[model samples]
Target: MTWGVVAIAGVLGLATPLLVRPLLRRYGVADDPNERSSHRERTLRGGGVAPLLAIGVGYLLVLALGNTAAVGTVLLLAGAAVAAGLLGLAEDVRGLPVMVRASLQLVIGIGAAAGLCIAFGQQWWAAALGALLIAAYINIANFMDGLNGISGLHGLLSGMVYGALGAFSGSAWLTATGIVVAVAFASFLPWNLTRPGLFLGDVGSYVLGASLASLAVASAMSGISLVTALAPLAIYLADTLVTLARRAARGEPVLRPHRTHAYQRLTDTGLSHVQASLTVSVFSLGAAIVGVLIPLAGLNQWAGAAVIVAIAVVYLLLPRLRGSRLPRKPQTALVDIDRPAAIAPRVDFYPKRWIVLGASGFVGSAVADHLVAAGHDVVRLTAPRLALMPETAANPISVERALNSDDFDALVRAFEGSDVVINAAGRATPDSPADADLYGANALLPAFVARAASSAGVARAIHLSSAAVQGRRSTLDESLDTSPFSPYSHSKALGERLFLSFGSPDGETDHVVIRATSVQGPGRATTESFRHIARSFVASVAAPGNQPTVVSSIDGLVDFVTRVGGSSGPLGPIMLQPWEGHSAYDVLSAAGGSPRILPRWICTMVLVVVRGLGRVIPEVAGAGRRLELMWLGQDQRSEYTLEFPAMPNHVLVGILSNREDAS
Candidate 1:
């Protein structure tokens, strides 16, 4: 019978989103990318409607069965959940004042608590305690709904635990409500986790919080221990309270939308959304299991309380623990460079305010870290939005608007008083099918950034462009025209032209473009891919692989950037780092590959075939480009000089060393 109810609820849960999504789209109920948001793309909100509808229907069916005991309790819980969800839906659609929402929530909480006390014949004071608990959990769930799968997973897991407790304790109302809640939320997971993901908004969180809190209160009033009743929500409660306390201590507005939560911090420290969500869910599950076991095993409730406390403490400490393991200082010497140290001169570092766009990306992160290590006051901006600002900045700017937006006022404000603004953000993937995204990031973003910096009276704007802009060119120099072949390179080329041509009406900012070539280092997917290929059995190079591959060490690039930023006079519009003597063969050898030399003609033949296939297979063209690069590396004129030091061979060798350490 319980399985039947769950099956029906699951069907509704799965189907409701399909019905609701089009309406959401029609109404433009989308969550846009903002400085505080974890998501980069605009996504639909108010997806909580699906699970809310599912739960409501499932509970109605339970009432229709007519033979269930505790009918009043079932009705009360279902009514409370629906009311809370509706209130949240109202808030989501038409924004409500914070006080209005809080007042409404309190009213609902008190009504639900009093009703539950009447249904269970509990004391009046118990209603007060239950109301406070329900109201608190409601907000806690809402606050913790920042990550995908977090709220849904919490609802699913907690519902299952509550249902199990109901079954074990012979409470039919609890059993029916719990199963309905679990199945409904479990069905919402796919919609939340997949691409074009949907957020629950406040509606879903309200339903979940209301349902779970009511159940916990009911379970305790029905003779279950307090520790057991609240176990499922321990992690969420702890996270919200701790975060709020920390903010209050720092004199920050506690109610403001921010991303300082422990789960969010996990992402800042390099964990993907899925990994961080799972980390929290896994610990919550463990704590919930402990909660259930205490009563079943006839252990002291205090013992269970102690165990949950320990779990919550560990979960709270995760961000700090994970951060401590990350590489704080740059590992610049991971590879052994064969070049003379004399070629590279030491740079005298001067501290200045710096803004690194795309600070979450590979090159951007490296540049930001390098700047920070040199004692520069650095501000890191992730793509489409800015994150952390320098502590010294008097008025911190919040550029929460999308980069594609018409207004640049927010960005200009962010760039104010900064010495150098490094535009390191771009779509670097060569074969990505998202043409619009590629163009938006690679071509349009730089122009916008430059305009903003100029408006802000910034001294210098260093835009990082790819060497791939000089496509199919065997010999390259700063003076050569762009010959971009692919969409990626073409976008980069467009960006370069736009950036170099951009001038503020006031002429306050100077623009410099750095064409970085084949940058490789630790923490890069490309470096890892190279390492894997090098270790493969069939790794081979075309004969006479002595062509200078346009490889640049990240360390060397950072060094060059530092020098360019520190230079006093106008250096030039364009700069290219001299080739640090590493050929295709040398790169392979340094990566621990003993490649069998194949005939150059054979490699050419393969490239010809791939290029021919590229007519039907779009991705094959990218492979052809790779083959050509390996066969005939770009030769650049090294005479166009900057005052920066030449990179050492050890910087190149450090790539492999870092790979080994990672393994």
Candidate 2:
């Protein structure tokens, strides 16, 4: 059954990667990241072996079971795909000359065309067209494999169209081949969706294109409409033809590798590899859908032509229009965080290109603005789920990894050709209370950044660490030994160690770690704070809250980064905070809330009650624990030595003022 054939192919497709990845790596089959490469690091190549192998095995099973009129044509299709895939594999392993490659492709295409003509009892004219189209499609598929997920999705969608057409035309061979190809690609998608995953490579692309071409050619031989047969591949065909024409007009080297394709252009402008690939795949699917439905609907020739033209026009224009609209100014306010008098100003230094990680986060966004405002070339790295605000979308760099994982290779790519790499990404809140989350972000992430910065030959790497690493010390300084008391603090301490260690080996990478305290800004406010104390305990809480102390503002943080960046000073760890700290209650009350104060005994009674409730309610436990810290704040108060200019007496008002101005 067709279902059984597809299911078998899908299982093989999924399993083949696991079997072949090690072999490819062992055989030294690797693709080095180049100027035109979508990936940042050198990764294993020859991933196509898996899917090609799957398709071959599936073809044999289908051939054995199916006794149909198109069996000889199906045999021709399988032979063509195998021949093309082998040629591609030869090119991948050992360099093949252009002439040799072309001669081989032509041989395979012509052979397939002759066989199809004989098997279908068709004329010489059909054979000539089939040969040309098959060869062309083979190359087009190879060209489109530059980005991740493009080839896989294209094969899947195109296969669907072919299967539908075959069913309509009552060709069992076409239907079986299409189903097998679609299922194989669907199974292989996960391995190609993210960075550090396998690519289809030349071999896989050749197999896909050849298989699809064979289906189309065979369909035409069966008296199916040529227009319907080619409709599924319209987007790919159009892009390939247009790119070829443009290159020829400019007299460029057409056979050489280049990044001028529309999809590549979209990536260059701001789209990620996945984003660009998906755009083309969706448009192609839409066109394929029309191809299948319009004939069934019996639309007139003129109307069908109009529909096809409209789809082509829209697909060609969408990327260009989207690229042109990316905003230069960042949506988040950077000026609000820049206080001229708060920290040292920028000294005389050359403006350097910078790469910023986690640009969608509160601190990262401000850092990006600071770099851009200073007229430095900044490439902001964003995750899949996070979109760059149009205000700051001037230019973007694609990092294919998600935010949570330790995708260090993406960092290396982003860090390439940059003078400085700023890591403004990390977990700031403890609401989730997962040790894995804290350790992954605060500890492991900085280590990854350090390695990437080193690998990219970056001049400097700055990491924004937290003062929480020191726990509740009264005399906070850089030299004081860290005694982290919580998961967040522990992770921060470990991260600081890892970052600082990067400079110890060979001293090539200048690493700077800033331990910042109580960073507050418009969006920097956290949900992880003191809660659930009785009204009677308010008085005791108010005393510690009102203690004079320094606070770190978002503006002060940015000023420190810029000034430190400008200086030619030696890289080392620094603790930064405002010179004066407003009492915790004074800062809290200033935010337009009625102050509550309670006696010490009442506070103790509330803590006991809250602790009891915390057994059943974890949230209550967190609240009760925070209240205990507030009660013990005076004992833990510290005079931090390294300081920036004081924000102001009315800190909350000044913060609001700064926020309003940025808006």
Tens digit per residue, CA lDDT, model 1, 1-663: 456778889998998889889988998887898978988999998999988999999998888876267777888788888999999898888889878998888888898899989878899999999999888888989988888898889999999999999988888778888889998899999999998899998899999999999999989888888899999989998999998777544434356677888888888889888888889999899899999998788777888899999999999898888872321211111111121111122145343899999888888898899889988899997656322121211111211233336445677888898988999999888875323466667766776787788878888788999888887777776643777655577667766765665446454567777889888887788888777777777567787878787876888788788778767644657777667778878887788888667898998898789776654444566667876776666787644454555687777877754654321
Given candidate 1, what's the lDDT at residue 46? Answer: 91
lDDT of 2 by residue, 1-663 (tens): 457778888899898888888887888887888876777877776777767877787777788886456568777888998898898888878869877998888888899998999988899999999999899899999988888889889888888788887778777777788877787787788888766788777888888888888888888787766677777788888887877666544433345576777777778778888888899898888777777765677656456556766787787777677763321211211111111111222335354788888888988899899889989899888622222222321111211132234356676777889887788888776433323455567666776787778888887778888776665566456543675544455556666765565433565666777766656667544411212122223524533345443344677667667655555533345444444455645544444334465565776787789766654444445456556545534222323334234445554445633435532
TM-score of each: 0.51, 0.49
Worst 10 residues of 2 by lDDT: 332-341
Quote the positional error of residue 440 for candidate 2 in Å: 46
**Which segments of candidate 1 are over 4 A away from where they belong?**
324-390, 393-663
